[model samples]
Every structure is written in structure tokens, then in C-alpha cells.
Target: MKVALKIGYEGTHFSGSQIQPDKRTVEGELLKALLEIGVITDTETADLSSSGRTDAGVHSVSQVVTFLTDNPRMALPRILNSKLPRDVWAWAYAEVSDDFDPRRHAVRRKYRYVLNADEHDISKMRDAAKLFIGEHNFSNFAKKDKNNPRSTVRKVEKLDIRSQGPVIKIDIVANAYLWNMIRKIVSALTLVGNGTRDIEWIGKMLDPDNYEEGIEPAPAYGLIFLEVQYDPEPEWMIDNYAIKHTNDFYTRESNRFLVISTILEQFVMQPEKGQDLD
Candidate 1:
């Protein structure tokens, strides 16, 4: 039997999502928690796999993973929560085909990059984002590597830009992404917003004939892996008890973070007007 899990994590403390020999990673911590829950006795038996890798400092709202297991009596979410660090949580699960591969089967992936509204021109950024909604070779806007030197062409289905309170959120939905693609796109948009580039610059960058190596990718901290959409949707649900409580906890946690971040920004940007001095 195999079970699919939907989880989320604050990636601030993790090296990244993939496993390495001596480094701490999301997948490594998850596998350890699985062991404590007795999902499988060994890696060979469990055969775990994740949807894809997330870079360090990148948060994920809905990451999916699957594993083969023989354990019948398993409280997967509850047990995983107990064993996992406070930042990671398993929210839902379902039975899936034995051959299910989360990465291969996903049809679309969505990413959201948040920028401080006070720092950039949100309206201009929104205008520039519209230029990305179609098939294009994103070579100038993606990080290239010898191991990943294949085609940089990819299709973007949607590029939705919106503002909420102090931040401007750019949500990009794509079939798949090349390394650092979203960040680089955001950097380009910011350049346009800040009057450093024109909207036409985005169009020219997508042309395969033009290659520019000066593209500055945005920082990884503000980007998030929003969710992955699968075909026909997977039949999945957490028991009512886990679902209700976990949802409540995550919602509250998110709001708390927003409040704290807003306060920090205000504290730094707007200090007390006057102070008594000896």
C-alpha cells in the first residue's frame, strides 16, 4: 500500500528540501519522523519521493510526498506532527496508486513572490508581469547549470499580481520552472517598476536571439512554493479531528507572522519622532 501526504514547512532553518550527507534538510527530517511513526522499517521498504526540491529559505504552503508502506494502523499526521520540528506539519493524506510519483504526475505548479510595496512601484511591476503570460525561452531569467543545460523554454499560464497591506504579491502559475526562474522574473519586474527598464525590455529578454547575463535574481527569502495541482485531483483528506485543529493552528500562525513582520518593518522605518537626552 502507498499513502500520499500534503505538508507545509517554514524553510528558514532547513538547508533545502533535498537530502545531503551531513546537512540538515526537509526531506531528511521528514524521513526521520516517518521512521518514528513506524511507516516503514527502512528506506527500501518505504520508497519515499517528493514533488520537487525547494531552495533554502524558500517556504512551501502545499508540498506533496508519497511512500510505500505496509503499516496498517497508522495515525500518520498526528504522529508526524509529534516527531517533526515545530516548523513542519503534516496536514492531509490519502491512498494513492502504488506507482505514484508526485513530481512526474503534477500538471501545474504555482509560485508567489512577495515584494515590499514601499520599496518598489507595484503598478509598474503589475504591468510588466503581463508580458510573461505565454510560451517563452526564459534563459536570460533563469539560473543555468551544466547539469541543467537543457531547453530553457517553458509556458507560463498565469501571472497574477496583487497587493495586500504592505506587500505586493506576484503569483506565477507555470507548467514547470527552471532554476531561479521566478526570482529572476521578479528582479526584472522590479527593474521596470523602479524606472530602470521599460516594459519592452521584458519582451526582448524572452526572445531566444537575445542573451543577457546581467539579470539579477531576487532574493530567495520572499519566494514561496504556493501549491502543485494534479490531474483529476488526488482523493485525500485528513481525519476531521486532525484537519480541523491543524487548519486552525496554521491559520493563526500565519496571521501572527504577518503581525510581527509588519511591526518589525514599522519599527525600523518609523522610529520615535523625539526622545529625551541628557
Candidate 2:
């Protein structure tokens, strides 16, 4: 059977999402678990695909993946969860078409950055987010590609600011992102919120032709892959039972994930040890 999976992970410990030699990585761990659980005989024949790539230290709540598998049984998510490590989870799965590719079918991607709101003005950040609501050139926000360059113009569907007790969550939805793009934009928005930079500075960065310098990217720990939206809603997503089942899975994870406690430990204890559930 061909299967699609909804995965969530704390990325603090992995080198990045991709598999590389001699590094702990999200994809590597996942494949290891799959092999051990008899999901596949070998990595080369699994035919795996992911919705997108996430940098090191970036978490995910609903990252998606698809793979061609011969396993005939259902409830793969629950089974995969059993074999995976504590920080990585497989929450939902459904049979999918052979042609469905998570990367190609996705229409939009959502990311959220959780920042310490105690030191910044939330009102100013709200105003600044409005400036990014349309298509703009973001070359200045990411690393320049000298060898194989892609277009810098991208569309922002929405940018929302939500405040909690001491944390401010900035949610950004876009067609896609360039390398370090969200971090750079968050760095700019934070400066505006902190009253260190004028709002016009954001407008200046939108100038299509010129790529500016010196805007530092935000810490990777604060960012997360929230979800992925598809062009035509997939059949698996329309199932009410799947929705309720995934919700139940999420609630179970919340009780055991200890997301907030892990972040606090990173802030208070030895972050260098990298055992804080990456």
C-alpha cells in the first residue's frame, strides 16, 4: 500500500531533517524505526517523500510525508509510534495514490516562531506584520545562491500575532520559504517590536533588486513547521474518524511531550548537552 503520514518532532537534537553521514537526524531516526518495525526491507526501496525540509533545531507539529509500501495492514501511525523514539511521533496515516507526492501537492506551508514577549511590544509587531501580507522579494532575508539560484519573489498568505502569558507566537503562511527566510523576517519584526528599528526598515527590505546586509536570523529553537496545505484536499484528510483519531493522538502526545518543560530546561540548564529533545 501507498501511505501518507503526519509526523511531529522536536528537532533540537538532530543535525537537520535530511539524512547525512555520521549525524543524528530526524529522517535517519524515522527510517531506522521503520526498518526495525518491518515497514520496509531496505531504505533504497522505501520510496519516501516529505512535504518540505526543516533546518536543525526547528520543531514540527504536522509535517507530512508519503511513501510506497507493501504493508497491507491499517493503523500504521499507531504502530509506527511504538517503534519511534520519544521525541519523534507518527500521528496519522492513510492510504494514498501512487502519484501523490507531499512536496508537489502542497499548496502552502505554515510556520510559527514563538518569541519571548516580555521584552518586546506586541502592538508594534502586529502593525509590522501587515506590511508582509503580499508578494515581495525576500532575497535579503536568505543566503544568496551563487551556484544554482532560484527566484526570490514569494507570496505571503498571512502573518498573525498571538500573545500568550510571556510568549508571542508569530504565525506565517506562505507559498514556500527560502533558507533562513523566516528567521530573518522574525529578526526584523522583533527589532521593530523592541523599538530599535523603524517600521519603514521592513519596507526597504522589500525592494526587489537590492539585497541588504546585517540582519541577523533569529534562533532556530523558536521556529516550528506548523502544517502543510494541499491544492486539492486529499481524501484521507476528509475522513472524520481520521481527524478525531489524530486529535486524540495529539492530546496524548501533549501529556507526554513536555514541550514547554523542555524549552525551559534549555534556558535554565546545560543546553550544550543537546539532550533536551532537540
User: Could you estimate the TM-score for every candidate?
Assistant: 0.89, 0.84
Q: What is the per-residue lDDT of model 2 for residues 1-278, given as tens digits with 9 covering 90 to 100?
A: 77788888889898888778899888888888888878877888888789988888999978887776677353376677677776787766667778888987889999999999877888889898899899988888886778979998889999999899879999999988888899999999999999998788888887746646658899999999999998675655334454455577668878776777777777775447545565
lDDT (C-alpha, whole model) for all candidates = 0.84, 0.83
Error of 2 at 53 (Å): 0.5
Task: Score candidate 1 by lDDT.
Answer: 0.84
Model number with the top TM-score: 1
Q: How close is candidate 2 to the true structure, as a TM-score?
A: 0.84
Model 1, 197: alpha-carbon shift in Å?
Answer: 1.4
As for candidate 2, its clashing pairs are 11-278, 12-278, 13-278
What lDDT does candidate 1 reach at residue 81? 79
Tens digit per residue, CA lDDT, model 1, 105-139: 99999999988877677788888888899998888
